[model samples]
Target: MKFAQPLWNDLKCQLQDGFILDTSWTNIYLPNAQILGIGKDITAHKQSKQVLNTQIEQEKLMRNIA
Candidate 1:
């Protein structure tokens, strides 16, 4: 299956440590809104992918060498 690209709407910052994530964020429409964020740590997944890619490239190089 195929899908269109996603819309990019995330703003990056350490908001809570100081404040917009520089005075403070204001959402006047939702005056009582509280924000919560969650994320996954993909270090293991990324390392495994890198190892697999390295092996694939080594095999390709060996084939060309032969």
Candidate 2:
């Protein structure tokens, strides 16, 4: 099955945040006909990390207040 544009866009965003994107393909007719690909987007990964860190800090603050 082919991936949708929205899904692809999301994947790209994640990649930009420094997350890694991996894909694999295999042929049914040939067991040995397999392919794999992997990539990383440093900018996205960094952004994602920052967002996660901010969320964690917020949660910690809330817990301390409670």
lDDT for 1 (candidate 1): 42
Q: Can you give the TM-score per candidate against the true fold?
A: 0.47, 0.39
**In model 1, how many backbone clashes occur?**
1
* Tens-digit lDDT track of model 2 for 1-66: 553322222233334678555433232332356533333445556578889999999999999999
Off by over 4 Å in 2: 1-41
Give the per-residue lDDT digits (tens) of candidate 1, residues 1-66. Answer: 453443323343544655332112222222247533334344455568889999999999999999
Q: For model 2, what is the error of residue 64's alpha carbon versus the real structure, in angstroms, after optimal superposition?
A: 0.2
Residue-pair clash count for candidate 2:
7
Error of 1 at 4 (Å): 12
Off by over 4 Å in 1: 1-33
